[model samples]
Structure formats: C-alpha cells, structure tokens
Target: MAPVSDYVKIDKNPSLQVTADHRIEVVEAPIEKPGSGKVLVHIKTTGICGSDIHFWKSGNIGELKVLGNCILGHEAAGEVVEVGADVTKLKVGDRVAVEPQLPCGKCFLCMQGDYNLCQDVEFSSVYPYDGTMQRYKVHDERFLHKLPDSMTYAQGALVEPVSVAYHGVERSSVTLGKPAMVAGAGPIGLCTLALAKAMGATPLLITDISAKRLEFAKKFVPEVLTYQIDTTKTNQENAVAIRKIFGDSEYVQPPSVLECTGVESSINTAAYVVRRSGVLTVIGVGRGDINNFPFMHLSLAEIDVKFINRYHDSWPACINLIANKVINVDSLVTHRFPLEDADKAMATSSDPSNGNIKVVIED
Candidate 1:
C-alpha cells in the first residue's frame, strides 16, 4: 500500500468562522494511521444534498451550527485506500459507499439494529465534524458498503438518499397494487418514488411547486402526476387540480400521502386529503415548531402520522436494488462539479430555480 502522505486531507480552517469564503481550502493535516477497525478511503464521488446547502448559507440548521470551518460533502462513495491494522472486512482499492453516520455501537437503538435513531452519533458534514469532500477519509469499516461492478460511483453516492426512501417506504406501509403519492418532488421525494415503485406501488404520483422537478421525475415513472399546487387558489380548487391530474385510478384517491417538503400548507394538505386510517409520512424538516394543523379534521378522519429520521440496516437491500437495476438511480443526477467548486454545486442545489434534480461533486 502507498504511504498516507500520498493522500491529502480536507479539514476545517479553525480561524475562519461563519464568514468563510466560497472555495473551501484543502490543508495537509497529520496522517494519522487508522487505529483499529477503520479503513481509509480514496473518495471518488459525493453528492451535494439539501442539508449541505443549509449549512453553507445560514451556517446552521436547528441545533447544529457552523461555529468553525468544516469540509462539505456527505452523500459520498469511494474506494478503500488503506485498512487499519485490525481491519479484515475491507482491503485496498475496493469500491465502497460510506454510511457517514456512525452510531455508538453501545446504544440501545444500535443494539436493536436501528442505528439511524441512535442518540449518540457522529454524522459527517454537520457541525463539529468534517465531511468526505477530501481526497481521503478514515471511517469505521462497519459503516462501509462494498459496491458491485454494476454500480457506478455516482450510483453509490445515491445510496444515502435511497436509504432514506427505503426507510420512508417501510414507514408508509404501501403494498402492491396501491398508489403512493409523493407530495414534494425534490431529490428525496423522487427517491421515495423510486423506492415505492420497487416496493410494488402500481402508480406513483408526484407534486411540486416547480414543474421542472415533476417533469424530471416523469422520465422514470411515467404514471407520475406532476401538478402545480396553486397555493393562492382555494383548498377545493387545489384538490380538484390534483384530482384532475391523476384521473382514473380507483386506488389514486390521494390517501397515501408522503410529505417530504415539510411546508406547513403541504402538511395541512396531507392532513386533509388522506383518508381515515391512511398513512401520512413526513420526511422533510419544517422551519420551526408546528403550532397549526387541521387537527379537528385529522382527528375525525383518523390519519396515521409518521416522521422518518434517517435509515436503519437498509444499505444492503438498497445496494442490491440499485445493482440489479430495479430503479434508475442515474437518471436522478442532473448536474455535477469538481470537488473544488463545491460551493457552486451547493448553491445550485439550494436554488430550485436552477432546475437541478441532483447535484454531485466528482473527484
């Protein structure tokens, strides 16, 4: 194996606070050898997710804030560069997708095989942590998923979002012959549509404020209904538009709603349209505490509310689905940039007017 000096480190600049500039700097830090149960990775590709943009712009999200400079790219895939002395699962040059979030193995959630919900976790690209935008990263071997030849670096980078969709699918409980309506046509929402179809959804209808996103999603799932929900219109008028868009399926009653945008009105719409006993999956994070809801109607209608955190123990299944071509993961990536231009990529992802379906940073 080559010496660790052959690789470069992208660490946070301690001096620069929230006023950091656009192009992130790559400095040479100490090349600490993997202690144990760890493997160094040569990053190949990493996707710029929506959360990355939030951190870049506001330098904060909820509790996590950028008090210091941080490397920025998390939904990533790479090849094993070196292994820790005690590591045996992975070897040098093996392609892999990183889970990014390492839960404390001793946590109760980890013991239950639901590490996504573990209270004590070290997630990359968030506050107080460096991300995978660098030339190399030393991560725990347990969090690495070996990539098959059928899966490309970009597709592997998508595993993170796919895992989220997988978790949402599990939460929604939509079986075969059912229609799964995704309320937001962002990357995560479209990923949910892919997973829903893989999970046997007959017709997957998607809605978004932007017609471009809906049009992009239509490339894969033809049965998708892309309707512009006019917020200015009356509730009955908007519902009627959705009704007209998805005309004709007896199962397309808009009951099985997957709300990913976390917009208050979208949430209210989910609360209103879903039938009694139908499931409403909330996957996106709202701005602040939600004080208002159609609670009276929701109570009378008896809607099952579910909020998806990340994903748990679903990497293998998602990888297999991608490798087997069950879903066209490549179609989702509409933009790409080099790691050095991460700021532009992040900004492009932040602006919906750009019509970027998925933005990736290539090595």
Candidate 2:
C-alpha cells in the first residue's frame, strides 16, 4: 500500500545520548494511516510555552526526560484532516482544540474524574512523546475538542493556557467581591487577571517589572493596578509598594494571591501580601527548588498555600467560556510565527525582557 502523506521525524539516539547535543531536524517519514478511534488533524495555530523552552534547552523537565529528538509544541488548534474508520464523534474539516494530554481512561484518578493526575498519561511536548510542531497530528478521538463557530483558530490555541488559569482559580476558590493580587504579568498571569474579573472580583491588581507587558495588560485590563518594579530597588522597596496598594492598615488584608511569575521574590510577595486565612495559589514553575519564601509570613498570617501542576479537565469548559465570550483571549497574543521559526520563537519566549505577551507558531 502507498502512503498518502509524509511526516517529519526527529532522530533519536537510543544509546550514549546524554552528551549528544540534541537538535530538531526535519525529515519525511511514512505517515501512519489512522486506525480505530483516531483522528488526523492539520494544526492551524500552536503556541510555544515555557515547558517547550525547557525541553529545547535542557531536554528534561521534572520527571519527564527527553530521550530523543522530538517535535515541540502542545498548545494548538487544528482542522480535522481525516478520521479513522471507527471514529464517529468528529468528522473531517472540524475545527478543534487539541487537549494534548491524554490520560489512561481506566486509571484510578480518571475513574474519580481527576485525569490530570493519571499515572500513565501521554502529554505532548514531554520527553519521549512527539509534539504538534509538524504539519499534521493524529490524536485520540476523545482528546479532540470541536471549537464553536465563533472561536478562531488562534483563540483555540489560547485555550490551553486559559485552562491553566481556570485550574489556578479553582485551587483558590476565590471569594467573590474580595480583593486579589496577581504577581506575574506573563501570559498565565494576565490570563488569571482576566479570569478573576470574569468571576466578579473587583479590578484584580497585577504587577510585573516589565513595562512592555504591563502596557499589554493595560490595553484590556484597565482596572488592573500595575507596578513597574525597578529591579534595582531592593526587595524591601518592592514589598513596600505592594503593601501600599493593598494598604496594611486601611484596606482588608490581601485575601487572594496568584503568583504566576515563578520567581522567588514573587512568592514572597504573595505570602506577605495575603491576609489572615488568605489563599495563595502558586501557579508558576520556578527554575528549580530555588524559590525562597518567607515562611514566617505564611505562618503568622495563617495563609493557606497550594500549587498547581499541569491543568486537566478544563478544555471543554474553557472553550465554552471563550465561545460564549466570557473572556477575551484573542487580544492576549502579541506575536505569531510559523512552525519553521520554532527555534526563534523558543528563543524569544526565553527572554522575559522581550515584552512579548504570547507568541503563537502557526503550522
């Protein structure tokens, strides 16, 4: 039988692979025809994420180790290119968001409706699993989420990150009408700010040192109170600025905090700012175990702390929210590149000083 299409492959070294400098090379391999319960998709827009950069430079993140060269993108939206014989839910030409992580359906966690913690899940852009950086991908039929007629491909790509914010919010269970603070102005941070407002919080305040990102957030989040932290200023000064906004004496203590920056200082700020019984949701992944925190503040303030792992079970609800216009995600993107520029896009995302809000790579 003749193959209908060609797929790109990233060569893998099965042995002595640690010292070898990994690079992504494009080569054509036979495209496997979809089998039962699979759907082939032609990706439209995919975004380079923080995890993607980690894999590109270091090839391993957390417990997931990259054993070989692999495609590197997970946040994506695509058009259904073909469907397997047994795939009935989705047909060709369907516009959908690819929820890149697929958990084992029979896992104990999945049975409890907590699939994100599935022990034997396949997450895209992780080590040993190829990503959606190429032209086409064949995904499990259950993982495909058809987009609403109002949602654009670019907007669909934003769903992955939006899901991250939704999970963070769920972790905090933010009290409506209470004041909240978001300490990172990155894509996830900005997304959290928007989500907070959508949930009825009063003008959630967000802070970042980068003027460009602050400006980007200012465009849609006018109510967002931003502080352009002068890195030259001592941490004490930054803390003082934060205290003044929430006001140690006048206003109610900070009850909710979202630390999305992943910096040690940001975590400290979140801890110190939240009031007694406040909830601080750590949504960022610090470079390492290096994030230092002021434990006394948390203990003294009686703050409850929780951290987020990768998000799951959020795609359908998130897409519905976006399709219903509950949140404006389209404006969050600042740049878009094709998959050919994956390297450049990764480099840009590495530089926090670059001021890019979100950069999407179109396939």
Candidate 3:
C-alpha cells in the first residue's frame, strides 16, 4: 500500500448536506484518505432515503436531530479509489455498495449476527457521522460489498434499502405460496413486494395512501395487487376493507404482513388484517409512541410483531437478487441529478407531485 501522503486528493469534494431545517446545500470540502482497514470510495451514485428527507426537511426524525450541517445520504454505490493497509478483500477499481451501518464488532449483538441492533452502532447520514453524499467516502472494509458486473451503480446503491426489505421478509418468514401483504408502497415497501415475489409469495398485495405510488407499484410489479388506502377512514374500517378485498372468509387472511409505513393507522390496519398466529414485521421508521394500537386484538389473535432496525446479513442476498434480475431495480430509479444539483434531487424526491419512486444523485 502506498503511504497516506501519496494518495490522490481532489481539491474540492462536493457534498450534499442538510445545513439546517428545510435546507440542503452542496458544500465543497477537502477529500479524505482511508484509515487502516478502510477504503476510500469515489461515490458514483447515492439514493435519497426517507430518513435523509426527514432530516433535511425538519432537521430530525423523532429524537435524532441534526446538530449541524450533516451530510445526507446512506444508500450509496461507488468505486474504490484508495485502499488502506490490511484491506484484503477490496482493492482500487472495485465497484462496491456501501452498507452504512457501522456496528461495534465486539458487541454481543454483532457476535450473534444481529449487529443492526448494536447499541454503539454509528449509521451514515445520522447526526455526528458523515454519509456517502460526498464525492469521496472512507468506509470500513467490512461494510463495503463489491458489486457484480451485471449491476449498475444505481442498482448497487439500492442494495442497502433492499437489504432492509430482505431483513423484514426474513423476519416475516415469507415463503412460497404464502399470502403476503406490504402496508406501504414507499421505497422499502416496494422492495419488500419485489422480494416477496422473488420468494414465490402468491397473491401478493401492497397498500399506500398515495394513489400515485400505488399506480407506480402496479406498473412496476404487475403480478402484485395494489390498493390505495382511504385516509378518511379509521384504521379498523380500513382493515375491514382490506379483508374484504382479500376475500378473507372466516378462515383466510394474509399471514405475513410487512408494515413499511410507520404511521399509526397503517400499523394498526396491518395488525388487524394479519391472520392469527401470523407475523407482522414493522420496517418503517416513524413515531416511537403509537396511539390506540390494537394491543388486545393482536394478543387475542396471537400475531407475532417484529421490528427491523436496519439490516444484518442481508447485503449478499440483495446483491444476488439485483444481479440475477430477481428484483429489477431499473424501474425503481425515476429521477437522477448530478452531485452538483443534489439539492434539486432532494427536492424532487420530497415532492409528491413529481411522482418519483426513487431519486438518485450521480457523480
């Protein structure tokens, strides 16, 4: 390995950052070198996650507030430009996907292969730690997965969110011929739907409050059923409606439900519609405290409620899924903006009228 001083440096590393509430800007900074056991990546593509939008718009998602100009992006793919000492797996010129979560490897959860729940985990785009929106990002060697030649940088970036969906699907135990319902047509929900299809989940269903998103989901996955939720109705009413649509008689209902919308109504509706002894995996990040949750109903039905923090041991599966065309992410990316125009990309993603499924920032 070459000495740190011999590393090539870009004079200005343009980074998209959430400077304050409702403000995101591209700021220039000096490029950084990879430390030991790390690799410096020239980020080629990055997906704007909902969490990034939350922090960019409101400066926080719940209690996780942005204290300063935090760089805003996590779902990213790049090429290794420099490799630090002891980096055995990756080398210069390798294309890779960034797994943004940095967990304490020595922690009990990490040893148990549940590092996503590690207490000391430092995730990208969250406050204090910078993210992959910058031109160059130095990440640990363990967190970067080399992308297949078949996968594009946008698809590589999608591996992060797809990994999250993979985790939820695994927790939900969605299998062949299992009737699965995803309660949100957002990025993660759409990903879960595709994975369910790949898992051979027959009669798949997806729901969302936005008709536009539901329409897009239908076009993207024509085999899956789509439902536009009536926001005016109560959660219980919506649940009954969903049951009616699924034609749930006295004995049949969706056994595996992935709640990708963290809204209270969506969660409650999912809980209500799930079959007895079924699994309800909550993947969306929303309010910590939900009001009027159907505690007694879920208890009586014996539904197993599971929650996903981010993901663990899911990157490879996602990579294979995308690389092998099990999940076609080409349609997922609706808009692209250069890194210099990242502000516009974020704005396009935030606006519902634009009808964007996924907005990507390219270098």
Candidate 4:
C-alpha cells in the first residue's frame, strides 16, 4: 500500500445527526471540501420541516427509511466560505439560500426545466443524503441562490418552502381576480396562501383543524379568510362552511385550490368545494394510497388535480418576492432555536398543542 498519509482524515465540524427514532444529537463530522463547480458554505439558519420531524420520530417517511444516521435539514441559508475551481458566479462571503436538490442535468426532465421531477435527483434531508443541518457543507454553486442584502438569514432559509408553494400556485394558475382556497394552515399552506394573495387571487381562504394555526394564518395575512375544520362533520358539510366564508351564494366556489395538508378529509373537502373546471394542486406529501380520494367526484366535475413532488425553477421568484416585501415571510417564523438545541426545536415543532408555525435553528 501507499503511504498512510494519503488517507489523512479531515477535521470535523458540528452537525446534528438523527441516529434513530426520536433521537437527535450534535456530533462532530468531517468538514467536506468543495470540489469543481462547488462551494463550501457556512450554514446560518435551517428550518424544521414536517418531513424532518417524520424522520426524527420514526426514521422513516412513507416507504423510505433512514438506514443510518443522516443530518436532518433541507431548508437552509448560509454564507459562502470557499469556492472551488470554475465557480465563477459565487465567491467567498456571499450569502445564499440552499436549494437542497441536485439533479442529473442529462435527464430529459431536467432539460425540459422540470428538474424537481428528475428520477435521479438527490434531495437533502432525505434518506441516505446528508442535509444542511451542519456547520459547514459543500454544495453545487448552481443550487445556491444569492440572498439580497435586505433579506434576513431566516427569510433566506424560508425560500425553500416558499418555492414549493410558488410552484403549486403556478401550476394551479391562480391569477388576478381568481378566487383561491388553500387547504391547511401549516407552513406550506401559509406560504401558498401568501403567494396566492400576491398573485392577486381575491377572496382567499385557508382551512385547518387547529384553531391556533388558523388564527396565525389570519394574522400573517390579515386579509385572507380562515376556517377551522371539524373532523366529526361530513366533507359536504365542511365544504358548505368553506363556501359560506366568501358569500351566501352557491356560485362562490374557488377556481383554484391548493391542498397543502395531504389529509384524506381535507383533499375530499377541497374536491367538494372547488368549482367545475377548476384546478387543484397537491403540495403536501401524504399516504402512498388514499383509500377514498373522491376520484369520481373529481372526474365528474372535470376538476384538474395536479401533484407536486418538490419545486422547480422557483427560487428566484421567491427571493424577489421576499426581498421586495411583496410577500411577508418574517411573521411566519414563530419559533427559533440555536444549532445545539435542534432536538428541542424538533420537539416543539412536532407538538400539535403548541403554537409553533415554523421553528428555525440558527447557527
């Protein structure tokens, strides 16, 4: 064998790792160096997503499981510390929001600008892929969107989820004067509601089972209407209540609905309320097989249902929206924690009883 010096171990950096179910700990990990077309970023803030909680609590999401310890964060913002060769767009000291996705550029989907759907894509915080919850990370330069000087690090981190919402709204085609409904007052739902409002969707409405969350959304966008769902009630009854928010007429159905809850009942209620020939975009990830999806109802109404995996080509618009103050995300961050307190942050976010809308970890 050659000299052992060739295998010298790199120094370690602080990183939060999920070792097993309901466990998270800060551990020292190797500091990865940036390679060609990559840049090393010092992570500043990371937002705890629902998917991250799923991994921390059960070590699995849907059919995917974390076979080993994985760093758990995808929504993040950071400053570039070092840039590798040929990285001309970015330099040291530049602040950016991590896109958290690496797609194979050669794929037909990528060429068609639908890179988020690329089958060979590698997403952060997913099984087997280390995420941005570390002190330092090496990422593709192309995936980092520069944060304007006016945007805060926390707002930069929010760009990821906002991007998801942006894509959903774009797909639903919510435009000026179009009535829109968002099913779920969660982070994604709130983001979708804000985007719909920015797109000039009038008489906007948001729904959730949690009164606290609904209240938060109402305050976040004071103009948008909020409704609390009663699980004990039938879908039709709940749909009627939702319609009543706009007016006392049956023709007040929204032309565009964004389902951000992924719950069976919420989706069915959306189907029940959306206008004929309307579009429904599914932004939340739910069960692999929904037993009663109201397929016949959707087919009969000719309501176009669209599903989004993640988001594609949405970072710039989100950044602009936040930077311009057109979409206010500053109020969406309800809880904040330091990097070392990641576990506590996760716990706070997971508890439905608490009023945590978005819990963020700052480095």
Candidate 5:
C-alpha cells in the first residue's frame, strides 16, 4: 500500500446525491480535513440501505425531510488514512467500519450509555450531515471500529446493518431455543434472522411479500419457515395465518418478533402473532403515526413493545460475529457498483424485481 498522504488535494469531493426532485445526481463538493478527535477515512465500500432508497425516492423519511441536495449512505467501511489531534486508538492504515451516528456525549442518555437515544445526534445521510457516498469522510474516532484481517471491505461495510439487527435481538431478550420470527426479508430482516439463529433461536420464521426475497431467505437459511404475506388480507387474518404456518402446538407461537418492515400491516400482524407476554422489537423506520395499531391486543397480552433508534456499542459484537463466521454477510452482497455508478446502485436496490438483497458501492 502507498504511504498515507500528508496533504490531500483540497479539490472536489465526488459524491452521490438525491436532488430535491428525488433524482439521483453525481456531484462534487470541497474535501474536508479531519478535525480534532476525528479521523479522515478513505471510504472503500458503502452499502445501500432501505432508508437511502426512501430518501432517494421521496426525499424524506417521515418528518425528516431533505431540505436540499442530500448525499445518501450510512453503512460504510474504509481505511483510516489521516488522524487528527487527540486521536489515539486508531492510526493510518487501519481498516475500520464506520458507525455513522454521532451523538452528543454530554447528554443524559449518552451518559447512561444509551447514546443512540441522545437528544442531539448528528447522523450521517440525515438532513444536516453528508454521508459516506463520497471518496473521503471525516468521522469521530469513537464511532469507528477496527475490522479484523479476515473481514473483507464488503463485510466491514455490512457491520452497520448487522449491528442494527443484533441490537434488536438484544433488546427483545431472545432466549436460547425459543421460537422467533422476523417480519421482513430485507437486508435488516435477513440480518436479524441470522443473529437470532446464532443466538440459538430455534425453528426460525421469516415473512415477506416479495417472493424473490422469501426465496432468497430460504436459500440463506434453509430451515427458516418462509411465508408470503397476502397484502389484501386484513392484519388480523395475516396474524392468524402466521400462527397457522407455525403449526398448531404449544410451542408453535413465537415469543419474540422482530418487525423489520415498519409497514403498518406487518407491524399489526406482529402485534397479534406474538405470544402472551412476548417481546416485540421494532427495528424498521416508518411513518410517525401508524393507524389501526392493535394496542388493545398488545396490552391485553402484556407484550413488551420496544423500539430501537440506532445501534450503540454494538460494532465490536458485530465485528466479532462476522469475523468468526457467526453471521455470513458476504453472501448477502448481491450487487456491487463503483462509486461513479451509485445512482444505478440505488435504482437497482429500490426494485425488488432486480433480486438485490444488498447493493454495495466500491470506492
């Protein structure tokens, strides 16, 4: 590898952006140097996430609207080529997985180690912060986790979503040998399935409306019971179908449910399917208000409904899982694109017919 450059050309930073009209554009901005407590990383690979597609297509995710041109990407891996003052844990040439959310360390939630719940968080790819779709990015050192030598750049980039999955599982308190179900077969849903299995969740079940996605899940985890949800059916009916698919037995109902789709119907189905006193972890980001929520059902069952913001203190566990082959993220990367073709990557990822489980952009 070449020596780290002491000074980089302060010229244009090639970036992928979503215009106000929701059009994908390749544009340029001025490069920035790492500030104190930060590191300048040469982003090697960035995974296109569902949230990115939401922003690219609608120019917003619920209330968080894109006021102007916004660069979109958060799951990224890179090489630390430059370190700023006071950065000690990492140095030049270190490979790292970039954790894109930067929370205020002084907040009450942050002090309690729930930084993801911080009131003032500057997350990448959000309204004010540019994401890692560019060639270079400056991030706080605390948010970057070193990748093991056995991990590829693509796998490193996947750590973000993996962490999200793991955090959901953790919050749900999934017990070993217990039944579990994931509500979607998207990247995060697949990740949740893999993690739940690794943690010893038996007879796993996953549901998705997309036949291609469900087929992909079957291939990913042959033992996982795959269900093709009927959208036309009411949520209560779908919930009944989920239970029936699990079979009629005392151990048939899942005690843990990870609702990864954020769709109202899926969430409602989850609300009904989860066993009494079950744990329901909502991992997907959806509209602020969901109509027809079966609050009475959830309350009557004494089910604990938990929501995860983003992951905090999860990178190390995610890295360990990937490095040890506990989770095979490498297989989830179905499409790869160069940084210049980021627009196409986003387009392909948005289309379920493309059969893209996960799309990555290489620098």
Candidate 6:
C-alpha cells in the first residue's frame, strides 16, 4: 500500500460543485481522509446522470432540493490510491465502481436484503451527503465493487445505471419469451432494453419523443422496434397508436412494461398497453404527485405497478453482464469531458437537442 501523500498532491481537492441552479463551478475543498474500513479513491470517470441534470438545471428533483453548495455526481468509477486501516478487500492500484448509496446495516430493510429501502441510507449528491464529483473521494469498502481488469472506467461508471436497469427488469419479472415494452430511449431505458433482451424478452418495443434517441436505440439494439411518440396526441391516443403498432389483437398487450420516461403521459400509456396481470415497473423518477393516473383501469386489469428507488444487491450481476459481453455499454458513452469543463458537460447533458446519450467526465 502506498502512503496518502504519494497519491494526493495536496490537502485540497478540486471538485465540480453546483453552487446554484443552472450553474456549476470548479472549487477546491479539503480532501477527506479514509477512516477504518474505508478506501480513498482517485475518481477517473463520472457519468452525468439524469438526476444530475435535474439538479444542475433546477437544483431540485421534485421535492428533493439542493440546499447549498453541493457536489453533483454519483455514477463514478475510480482507482484505489490509498487504503484505510483494516481494509483487506481492496488495496492500492485496484480499480473499483463506487456504489453511492450507503445503507445502515442495522436497519430492518438491510437485514431483509432490501438495503435500498433502509431509512438511514445516505445517497450521494442527494441533499446532505456530498457526491463523487471531486478528484479524491473516500468511500466505505463494502459499497465499492472491484472492477475487472478489462473494464474501462466508463464501463465502471455505467455499473450504477446498469444495476438500476437490472433492478427494474428483475422487478418486472421479464421472462425469456415474454414481450416487453420500454417507454424511454434514454441511457437507463436503453440499458433496460439490453438487459431485457439478455434476460430473454423478445420483440422489445421502445418509444421516445426524440428522433435522435430513437435512432441511437435502433443502432444500439437493431432487433428491437423503436417509435417516435407524438407529443401532440393525447395519452389515450398515444396508447392506441402503440397498440396499433403491435397490431390489433385480443392478446396485443405486452407482459412487461417498463416506464422510464417519468412523465405522466408515458405512465398512462404504459398502464394502457400492459397486459392484464402483467407487471408495469416505473424506473424513472418523476414528480411526487402524479395526476390523471388511470387507477380504475389498473385495478380492473390487476396490473402490478411496482416502483424502484435505486438498486439493491445488483452490482455483481451488472459487472458480470458487462464483463461477459451480455450487454455492450461502451457505445452508450457518446461524449467525454475533463473535470475542468464540468459546466459544459452538464449543459450538454441537459440539452436533448444535442443528441447526447451519456456524457462522461474524465479526470
């Protein structure tokens, strides 16, 4: 193991901070030391997630507001530069993915294997806890997963979103022959498509308002069908269009519907298109109160509406899926920028017209 001085040049860490809405600045902060059972990581790649864009654009995602000068990032991968006391799992020079959610082990949810629901969990970049946008970040070893030698830093950063996709897919219980529909062409939605295909979901359908995103989805997964939604149409009319695309039959409904857009219209379309007794999983983070939801239809159809928070115990599966080539995430990274241009990166990510899929910030 190397000393902290060898890996860190100075006590201050250069970080990308969201000082206010639509503003990001490079600021210096004191480098946090790794305590016992922790490891200090030199961040290599950080992905600009949709949530990061939400914070950057409005400084809030629904009710969760950024109260002060907050570091803005969570999808991170880096190398362990210094190991804290009693850290045996990882040593210096090991590449790892940072799982930003810290769950309190003593909670009932943690004990029951649903750690993401832990009441005391502290998620990075969410309010009180600072994120991994800085040059150096110290994280508990238990939440960090070691990346394979062949895995790129970008892929490691993707592990977080991949895990999210995996959780949604698992929640929907997508089977080998079951047909699945994903209602967003963003990174997470694309990931959901890949995982659903890997899990044997056939004839996948994906929809989006952006033609660029739909084109990207077509190139990424040529086998799946892509649709460009018309925002001018009503939710029911859009649902009818989707059903028409799948053809008019008694069994036209898909068994699994993954709504990744986080829009009320998309959710309503999902509820309308899903088969009776099928699973409809909401992976996108939308507003706290969703109005005009078709509650009567959902109840009459007995469609299971499941919502996901982050992810729980999905790191290993995501790593293996990427390592084994079950899913290719390398192409998902469309843009890259250094930490110095964090503001530009955020701006690009927030703009849908730029045709950016995944924007990564490299150290």
Best by TM-score: 6
- In the range 1-363, model 4's lDDT, one tens digit per residue, is 111122323355678888765578888878877888998888999999999988887778787688888999999999887778888899878899999999999999999999998988888988678998888888999999999999999999999999989889888858799789999999999999998998999989999999888889988899988889988999989998888887765566798989998888888899888888888888887766777788988999898999988888889989999999998998889899988788788889999788888999998
In order, candidate lDDTs are 0.76, 0.77, 0.88, 0.87, 0.89, 0.88
Clashing pairs in 5: none
Model 3 / residue 152 / CA error / Å: 0.7
Better of 3 and 4 by TM-score: 3
lDDT of 3 by residue, 28-92 (tens): 85677787898888899999999998898778887788998788899999988888988899888
Candidate 2 lDDT trough over 10 residues, lowest sum: 11-20
Every candidate's CA RMSD:
3.3, 4.2, 1.9, 4.0, 2.2, 1.6
lDDT at residue 317 of model 5 (Cα atoms): 89
Off by over 4 Å in 4: 1-12, 20-22, 248-250
C-alpha TM-score for every candidate: 0.90, 0.89, 0.96, 0.94, 0.96, 0.96
Candidate 2 per-residue lDDT, tens place, 158-206, comes to: 9999999999988985778888888888889988988998888864778
* Cα lDDT for residue 310, candidate 1: 83
Worst lDDT run of 10 residues, candidate 4, spans 1-10
In model 2, where do residues sit more than 4 Å from their true spots? 1-30, 233-237
**Candidate 5 per-residue lDDT over residues 246-287, each given as its tens digit:** 778736689999999898889998988889888889998988
Spell out the clash pairs found in candidate 1. none
Model 3, position 340, has a per-residue lDDT of 96
